[model samples]
Target: MKKEIAAVVFFLKRLIKKAEKLEAEKVDLFVERLTVALQEKFRGHWYTDNPSKGQAFRCIRVNRFHKEDAELLRACVESGVQYTDLGLPKELTLWVDPGQVCCRYGERNLAFTVASFSSDDSDDKEDVTKKVTSAVERVTSDYHSGSSSDEDNGCREPRYITGFSHRPPYQQSLLCHRMAGHVPVFCGDRGDSRRHVVLAQ
Candidate 1:
């Protein structure tokens, strides 16, 4: 089993190179990081039909972890240390999205939501233009009518996110993304259903 996991890791490293070849910029790998250089490796799959890397790593750790690791996990979540707040290099930031760590496990019975989103380079300028225009119009109306708190607090800038996970229907790690350079969001949200499969021999 360990050998099989190792092979999957090795295969993902090669797939990362393939993703790089498809784009010009050096990509961010959100997988396992080296303790030496703080470099992360790709730990996911290549989507042949779509632009994505699927997060489906089998967790041997679940079956063979130190007994105290659970306590550590619980503590980390309680500390409110958001991994997203760790101002990493943008390249590295886009690699993996870890489950929001929490001690209480969430259920997997939620309705699965397959989100249809655009890649950063997707030809969706019209949509963006419409959104921005609508936002401006709303703000303008509110300001004219004196009905918004923004007049006192100032308007908060619209936060623009390039890519977001189309979370799996069942709260599992079965979800994937369509990122530039074909990078995948290789981790589960909330660590719901913990399962992985070998997509290749």
Candidate 2:
């Protein structure tokens, strides 16, 4: 689980480096420092999908408009790096789109949503991963399940995901990107049914 999280962070940092075209040594230094900042202060709110609204992606949201961005910026300043040059935006969101397992971290809010997939009540004993499992089922079923009335109605079903299981998805740590190197902003709003696959906390 730690390896999966690390892989995701590494992938995002690499994209930032390439986009900014930083020197190799500088990339290493900045990424290292930024990683520390993230580990220390990157608070994420995990959200499940809203399939009823035709939304099919699950995401972990970090509102950069809040104090988290400031901590990250302070980390950059201490490391003698400019934050804007890194091209991170006012919001950082990580999403698991349909048919993909790994997360896509982005600079913009996917869109405003009002789906109540989660409970704010304190009596809820389920962990975040349990709450997120149905969404993963929808994702994985997209491959095996044929076209349904849902698709005909212009609604996309959520697809497969990994690293969320009590059973390991793979014996070895394999880094796979569903989309090739492009940081895309998919405009849509989407959840899970059927079998539940719980994610590690």
The parts of candidate 1 lying over 4 Å away from their true place are: 1-44, 48-54, 58-105, 118-120, 123-201
Worst window of 10 by summed lDDT in candidate 1: 100-109
lDDT of 2 by residue, 1-201 (tens): 222234334544544554555566666777677556554542332212432221222333443233245444655677677666654432344433222224322331123211122233442324333323433333224423433221233434433333333433342122222222222232121143222322111
TM-score between candidate 1 and the true structure: 0.19
- lDDT tens string, model 1, 1-201? 222222323322333333333222222222232111111222333332433334222121111112222322332244433332321211110111131101111111111111123333353545534433443343233334433221224533332222224444454333333211123334333344443321110
Stretches of candidate 2 exceeding 4 Å from the true structure: 41-68, 89-91, 95-201
Best by lDDT: 2
lDDT of 2: 0.38
Sliding window of 10 residues with minimal summed lDDT for model 2 = 108-117
